[model samples]
Target: MRQQMLNNGQQRIGKGLQLSFVLLISGALIVSSCAKIEPVVINEPAYLRVFNNLRFKVTVDNQDQTHSTLVMLINPEYDSNGIPAGAEIIGDFLVTRNSYAPPYPSHIGNSLDVYNPEYPGKERVNAGPILNGFDLSSWAQVPSGQHRVAFYSRPRSEVPFFNLEMRYRTEPIVDTVLDLRAGEVYTLHVLQKDFNTKENGILLRQENFHKLALADSLVYVNFYNMSAKGFFEAPHTVKPNSGNHLLGGLNLEYDWFQEGIREEMNVFYVAYDERFLRQHYDGTIKPLASFMTHLKRDTENPATAPYWSLPLFFNAQDSIRSFLFQEFFFSRPGFDATPESFMIPNDGPEGPGAGGYARLLCYGNGREEPPAPRRQNYVAVPNLIVTTHSGEHNPRSFATVNSIEIVNNSVYLTTVQRVYEPPVY
Candidate 1:
């Protein structure tokens, strides 16, 4: 009986040992599987978009090279004091190069002539010229930090102007420093404040370029106010006139003061009305004749509507401490009398319009040509100062709104031009 009892105890101990071994092996397999699993990684890239809003027309006598500006993005090696040792050319873009005649206006021209350091005259491979008005579809990948930008103008050889050493001469324009963050997109607007002085300035604006999943009814618009003069010491406010009251009633989505760099206004709900009209030459008001008629919102095809609006209004202070709209007013006669004639139409769907996000820029500088009609009803619409006759780079004119198709979530630019005509009694 004792021997049997001892054998039973041994069997029970063997079963217990087997269960322990199984548990240990199971735990080891679980840890090994966990170690083999890898974490998923995602890469985000930095992007840059540049716009040559400068009015520097490079024409030789009668020749029109209005779009000969060359833009470059440089990444300089910093010294111990955090200063750049030498700028390394990273991006080269040629803007508004081709002849933009009537019918098909082309803003994409040639690439910048990048001479190789090792072999002069040999062009280096670079991301080509960005089309004027439109965003750089191809994002320029750059390091997330501060960077320097330079602008150059290619000499027009037609006038026998010869720079034996260099094909292009660098403009006196000041280099711009940008603080870029990883996974963010930036837009740099190179503007020439005064064509007479050839003064240059830059406006830097940042954007979130991440692809968004938005509802079908929704779209995004961004406004950039680049109309303010940078070189002039005097305030950029418009000269006091009664016309300023037109804009006083309308609330702007976003307005950038001369001191402000850039701002992203809140997203607006799509809305449009045909209540706007232009005054005819014969004391008649024509409905939907003005550029503001294009502000209508289309739901079935949002691309047919204006997504972004940039209304440039200058304010001048009166002795009475009141503000008035400087240049744009109502009661102007003749179709050509108002600066509205110079505005490029927003290409609608199936039309030449770029479609997605429509950018409308309304500009007027209080200057009107001789034979100016007397101001009546406290309404006056001044014509934009025509700095360049080339028609491509009108200093007073607004940038062309490229057609953008809203297949997915996208951003656009827009502006407003108000016209006041007496209501028919």
Candidate 2:
């Protein structure tokens, strides 16, 4: 089977079959906000600024299970036949900042009205909502970076709701660039700070509260080998029901039959279904307070890996026409805010939508650009930054400055090009 498939791959490569795919990257940036100061009482001030907007090019893989398997089966139960269907995913993910900021308002309200800290308040009427999910047609254009990207997911019960407590995996911050395509779900959540604007002002700051999802059913990953000529294609699919089967012990055997294959070869693929178990939906999986809590506790059991593995699949075929099928089934429907439902309260920084950031920024080079993404083409999560006082308010206008340059964790004095001063409102 392997020999036949490899031969088929060679032929496909000869024909230049471009195999489509996807990947995701996470990174961070250091930014400082400059706010106008008015004579006011003092406190330990932390400035809220627009850090670079993170650009993640997510590429979905068919074999790399370690990073793709966000959830896996623990202990499973099967009936007379073996058919995997459901399992709870338990693992941690990382979040990072973007290199470019989208056209969205800062969660903080505009100057005329103050944003409410507790509630998001009414979304602005004039603002057009920005879709924050996946874009497949142009996954190859994302640049490289070093930082973290936030991860989020909706629960099985609440398809319309986001920000499930299981969202926001924080560890494993730094890594290589990511490539993303269709037939995958990428969660993006934001984190920012909010301040109490004096007055009956309603304010909103981009907090880590909002969670988003990029629901791409089939993404294409492109492979490059400068040394090799022609393009090759090998189609595969992520087994949504891999580890979780139906009432019997019967699991699904993925089948691929193409037009060019010889009749002598069998089309059977072999990879253990370990991603889900029936017990997950039956209330056997325990929910923890957070993934960090799971990581902190010490436990030894060979049955469980220290972290959850990203789910991936392997496909075997000797045919040239069978295209890959990647899909995430929904027994329930997904929800999103309409243009009317997406708005920021008055009194905080105006969001990109309100400030005319609803479309992708034009990087004009005299080239005709692609069309805008369709509304149904993407998903967005509303991120809200939250804050609480940890120390007494210092009502004095005194300033303290410190500087040092570090080389290999060692510090040295250096001249300053700019000084950071917090915004005082």
Candidate 3:
């Protein structure tokens, strides 16, 4: 009786042990079936901006013609199944900006305008809209490292770049690689090095767009000499024939610098013409800013190499406690209404533009020769004297400037302006 009882108890214990093992396995399976997971993808970023300054000469119907219009394409994306997503248009209808001042006002119906009750949409408009400004809300992000870039000439028309036919992409003016560093900003310039040879290429330069310290009254600036090799030469100054089929025999009478107008010559800064040369010869006048031809491009880091500075306001208060302001850079030539510096390059004063200046008593006046730029004309004309202030009511509202980029005598004043202003200060 005792042996039979022990055997039965042992059998029961074994059954219980088997049941516990099965339950433990089932519990683990249940937990494994309910497991959760989350996956993510992160892209390292670098910044790049494009400028299509390509004014290259192309042979059209056996005639050479120069154009500034360009369409740029960066690394296009592709899907996982080896299907093309689309070619991204990094830059489209990009032409070198002629004059960046007195920005094209945004009328009432502009899409970018906001609601202002006091200043009705119809009553007042945004006075300053940038010329070919980029969206500053977000910098163009790309994975750091090498990027293939290409520039093609497209028709200057209402059509978008992608809608254009395959003919436009047949001939790429500039196709190159732009190796960028992570967390760095850059500007890719498509340029024509020489009009004679039409040597087209790309130049990538690291850019610094941070505003300078706004504490003191100052106007900050820097200079870049992106002039072509044939600048001031005949090949660049003279335009090729567009409709000279009638002048088949007399080819000498082709369209060339007609009406005393020249292109891509010396760009004078302050006086625009002779003051630049005279200032160097005699120490009578020093320009607020001056850049000699063949000026070297800077490769220094932005933080270390700050911009050149100029006074924002002139304090001419003697005893009456009156504060004066400068209206025109070249208010009256030779007079100190402008900065104490007046001399500009003898050939141009470095044309900022053709506004705000008149022929004010200098070598350029009373000359019988064509109004074309002279080699050493004593007094020069000014493009315009730069103003320190561009605001009406706010004294601290200094003229907003980001970069003064010059390419083929076309100046681009790029501003990283804020598009939206919150209601509260």
Candidate 4:
């Protein structure tokens, strides 16, 4: 009985924090007759999603990378009665692994016994906060204008976000006000920009999941290079990947002598084919599909980084003898621009092994699930998709991965799910 009362108290406190956070940020938006100060009003709603790509003290490829889970506090000290108190906890112990959290109605709460007998294996049995890579998290809504939010490093322990000890010890990593637009979906990415200075910044990008008219076999994919300023130019031997460990460079001496690497990155892939084929770096086997794009120059470099999405043509249709996984690579220019032979010398792991080629994200769309011990359905690759916004990585019929976020040596994914039962607005 006492535990239940404690739970109810926490709920009440959370509600009060949400209410006050908005009011304080909005500041009444009072309207004046002579000097009109437009009041901020949220008619519909603006959606938001966040990613924690902020590399911290963890050493990766000889450099520090982000390995900390965070807790987000809104109005750390505010209440409805104008009293300063414990802050509201929105995101707790949020990590890089992708989990699902959409805006939901308050009454429809998440439950452990909320299972359908018709679908036995579908629901997680003892799922707590995170299940099936999806959590009962919701997008905390706010007026689409400007709002203050702070992210702090929290311990993976019994201490809750509301505890005074935790709050006092945790320091803010990201503290700023965000300017948002109404009726627009936004994704906020906190990235570690520099290693020496230990500075981090957020990259806010508009997310669009609007249905695109495409065939069932096609999936949309766009690549955004969010690596540090000198990602390509840096001498990296090994970097952190999604797996227990996923990064190992082939060659990283480009920076040793100021060698100008190739501008375009070679992308090589083979779809789910029944031909029983394999790709080799010795130029024997050819990739089923291949494309090339220019790499984003380090912010420190004189070259300008392109800020547009590339719609790569990918077919994820499953077929007979179809392998449940796909492998792809990004390498510097080769003899003829082909992935196998026309590649940088010793780019892959095998023959002579180097770093230029060990950078690729491997996720497949197969009919049957692959072997167990998978990373949210993605296999180990050179550079694994460290985090994802959605778990629908391997869409059965093949769907577009609309938003693909890439960091220095990590990757995050969000796919356009095919509507089985469309939602009625």
Best by lDDT: 4
Weakest ten-residue segment in model 4 by summed lDDT: 116-125
Taking the tens digit of each residue's C-alpha lDDT, what string does model 1 give over 21-105? 5555665665666676453332343555544443331235524333434434365454475433345553333443111111111
N/CA/C clash count, model 1: 18
The TM-score, computed over Cα atoms with residue i paired to residue i, of candidate 2 is: 0.15
TM-score for each of the candidates: 0.35, 0.15, 0.49, 0.55
Candidate 4 structure quality by residue, lDDT tens digits, 308-332: 2222222334321123244444555
Candidate that scores best on TM-score: 4
Residue-level lDDT of model 2, residues 68-140, one tens digit each, is 2121111222234342222221121211222212122333254443321111112222221222331111111
Q: On TM-score, who's better, 2 or 3?
A: 3
Each model's lDDT: 0.31, 0.19, 0.40, 0.41
Clash totals for all models, in order? 18, 109, 17, 12
Ranking by TM-score: 4, 3, 1, 2
How far does residue 42 in candidate 3 sit from its true spot (Å)? Answer: 7.9
Instruction: Mark the regions of model 3 whose C-alpha exceeds 4 Å error after superposition.
Output: 1-42, 56-67, 76-85, 101-139, 209-216, 235-237, 240-306, 316-396, 399-402, 416-425
Model 2 regions lying over 4 Å from their true place: 1-42, 50-53, 62-425
For residues 313-384, could you state the per-residue lDDT of candidate 3 as single tens digits?
344332211122111122222233333433332333224322112112112112222122222212221112
